[model samples]
Target: MEPPNILSSIPFKQSPLNPGELNLTHYCMSFLLSIPWNDISVTGFEYLAKKYRLDVFSDTSNPNEVLLSLAGKIILIDVIIPTHGTYRDIRIALAFADATGEQYKNTGAEEILLSAIHENNTTLLERNVALLAMLDRCSPSVQQSCFQYLETLKSTFSLIYTSRLNTQAFNDETEIIMSAEGKPLNDNDGNLGLQLAFWKHQDFLYTAKISMNELPSNSLPCALYGSNLVAETPLKTSGEVSWLPETTMTQIPATMELLFEDYHIVFPEFGVQSLLDFLQITDLDLSENFLPYKTLLNLPNQTTAGYPSMNKSHIIYLGGIDIPSRSVHRIPYSHPRQILGIFQYVRQYLTLQTIFENVKLSSTRITATASLRLNLIMKQYPVIHIQYQELNKLSNVDPVIANVSVLPNGIVQLNSIACGNTPINEDTALKIQKMLQKTLNIGLVLEFAIPKLFNNQ
Candidate 1:
């Protein structure tokens, strides 16, 4: 059995009133006038009709119940007015409820009417009540029109209620149920069922639905009737390969275990004497290193006899190098330069050796564990390390460093020189230390190493 489309079951009648000529105010007044009020006073009814410019009492047959009926209709539609003008309006509006002995009751139509009269605005109350009453007898098209009109009025009365009714009507006409897997299911005995399908292509997913219903005259799917079931188009993209410029070396243990046996090779502990021996053996001249230290040390000796004696205060320590006390024999200026030269050479050599060891160990570990197939692939592509010496170099133009200490555990400690002209302050030093620790994931300690004189001196 073929099921009928839900849309065909809803009755859609045209309204008698032309859409363009609809006026809510006049419609409400007219609806009130048509109601037969058979329980109202002749004098009071005439007063109300005159107040609103409405002619509702032309043929008053039952004077006793005429006003009562009018009040009942007004209350039924929930019309209300404020009590601004001396109890006159409230007295007349609640007259019917009061006469029927329902004025003081806590619950019922009468109490609601009395509350509405005391609280709500009369103008908005009348328009909303009239619109609701008229909508009951209105055709679907006319109801849609009236709904639009009520929206523009912004009365905040029956707008939500009327919109809900429209939505209910739409839902009833279109009975669509979508399953959890996004399949549209139709239990109705329709001509044929439609099925929606999805397919994944590369990184994107595409969706389409097919129906057995008769195709439209201009549909392109009809042209492929007896030919291939599907068609394909190639998508274009740039063929360039992209690579990350910077990659970190994974952290390996300081010591590694061997399957068969273990052996360790400790590098010779080179000192200042070893460096001196190397310099002498290589026949390297130490004149360049001695020049800067010598110039500074000779300042006091060269001063004229009449000139004020240049004390320890005159000698400024750059690079945070400690000076011997006056009482103790002063070491020759040549010693410090020799120490510095040896320190610089050893530091550079150790840094390079560490890098070589790390790279070699990493390659050996990878080769041992990799499968035969992986080994062949890896042999074709060898590991390469890119070294940038200046990547972490400090700016020589600012933030002068007095001394630097590199610990065995990969910690680099810096001491800032205390000079009146030096740019680095406590705050700037702290910031640099934190940034270094965060970026390199290493320990960094900063200290101000100013030279202080003892009381004995």
Candidate 2:
């Protein structure tokens, strides 16, 4: 008979996670759309405005004012379209409204509005294509209404809009800040420094600076100035983009070498040594076994503490490389609980690596073990799982058994360790125990989840 699968017998269930402040999906302000007053109608627009009802002034004298009805409550939305500026420069005002039509003062409304608008935009775009293909089959009036809605919606829709007088757009403010030459990139107090650059060619913004501390004393000063063409997308309408070197140009920091400037997208993987150096974590003497399984990188982004919004920001989490397949799986940092749980697993792996190296130096043979049990404690429930893997192979050696646990506050605790020969010395044993109890020293936490646990297998 074959040996039983350790994962098959364990019971696993979905548990609620306390994401804490790490969740960046929600925004402080509500979402808004800025279509012209004439476009709001009874027939062709129904698909776009499903549940919410729009009330436009019939007097034609007050075309700038529009009211939105949500769940029988009416909220005001101002429609202001500038005649002179480009389509990208137009600004509209929007905010969350409750059932009573007043402003929704509660947090988390932005997440709902963002989701709703994205869904609406997707449906409209999909239908617009189908209607265009069969335009010749329809009447002139239907064609006129359909074309009006599509054109107005495309030019007016935006996530970054002003609800208050002091509200500033992200890209515009970032451009001005980068252009100011004489000022230092970081404040003298050494707080988090974040710099963002929009790449027109790639259509995705790249983070220019994301360090928690100031640059090295010997490092060159930041040499970033605002680009001339940040949002010029005339070629995008035709669906045919011609490559231009000018579009790829970015304000490079003086610290980055030529190699880094070219392939900066993969900085999370290549910048590990820089992170380790900054943290002052030296003399690791890392082995192949430890490097493969214990490595992780935190994506660079601004802190969420006291920040107003995160609707436009992009977040990424990267974990260790799978040696066999050479595939790296991304860990979603949607919650603080998920991050802590993954880090707990990495702590266990590091402890195992230390034990193996100590044994090898002492000329003691250690037989590969089959099972290790780990407990992950959360606020609501405690998760128990078993790992089956061998550190190394050796002849005439004793098998080892280890049990580990992680407290809710992210402190790793070594429950027990057993070996037939007691090959681990007191000094080595004490060192391993400390490594188990250590907390992560990084400013932001990036973690690795047990593949089985995340997959709910």
Candidate 3:
């Protein structure tokens, strides 16, 4: 026969209250019921109570009897805590019945207790009192453990609260100040060694001069100028003064000036409308890949160069008109003249012509019958001989041979072209040779007769 399951033998019932409705008493009772009380030592009970923050003392109560009384007290505390709701009458009735070993039907006391606890906020002191009273009735070990746990909780709470208060105080009292200018100024005492002056022009340009008693010890003194505040380097510096200004457009009613080390600048009729207009343009929601032609056309004439004469209709043609379309299919082969025209168009923009030295061509039936000559310059060879022949309709083979000779002018020449049994005519060959000489700047092959003096020697 199998040994009995001790937990199964013990009387345990599920609480009628829902999870949200359960109170501290329900939790405590559940915990107590789940433990194998017979196996747990007196010391273990004390340790558990302390760990759980239950106010139970080890020395004050009988270990066995205290367990039952502790359960009763937990019930009482749960009922008494106003926040948890008053189940005092129900608890007392249960206690009386249990004392007399009389069986009583469930009166929904657990549900009522849970409802009261959740609805109210009991004071910490009151909660502590309830916990202490509950632990006082528990086993000696349980009481000891509970009391220790509660004490530790209280100490931790106090420490965290105090630290938060100190941090708030420090943040409130501390103040940090930094000078926007390079150095501090004492203008009140009339020791004004630094001075800034401004001059304005009709074209909305301003010039500023900064005069100082001595040169700056650290990095060069920087001045911020412009309606939108741009940093400007000094234009020219004399013995004790420097000019810090830039030739930039400004708007009417202009107050823009150079700002440095507490020195102030004032200009007459400076305008800020231009800067605001620029900022507004910058803030526009424009497409990343495409420009908005309509937005550009709507800009003020003064804001854009040649805006008055710019045709708005032309903008539509310009917008995305130049962008290549994905839907357009590529032409694999075109008329040889058309291909040559494109090559010539591209070649006009090319600074170097060495890229065409050894042009690789795939023979296709589409351009097989067409004969074309291409000029190219080779860096290694003075002359290159290229021969092309069609073995059959399927394949046209071409072999390239470079005949290089250094000329007297230190130039490489490619002066020969031999087409073996190909469709190239005499005119095509002569054009090819001439084109090569012109493109590569190769000199003609010179013929010289040997002198009689050299023959006699």
- Name the candidate that leads on TM-score: 2
Overall lDDT per candidate, in order of appearance: 0.24, 0.26, 0.24
lDDT of 1 by residue, 238-301 (tens): 3111211112112111111000001111112132224336434221122211222112222221
lDDT of 2 at 16: 34
Off by over 4 Å in 3: 1-143, 167-457
Candidate 1 residue runs with Cα over 4 Å from true position: 1-68, 71-110, 135-457
Question: What lDDT, from 0 to 1, does candidate 3 have?
Answer: 0.24
RMSD after Cα superposition, model 1: 38.1
For candidate 3, what is the total of clashing residue pairs? 30
| Model 2 vs. true fold: TM | 0.25
TM-score of each predicted structure versus truth: 0.15, 0.25, 0.14
Clashes of 1: 12
lDDT of 3 by residue, 237-287 (tens): 321112223344122111111222221111000111122232221211112
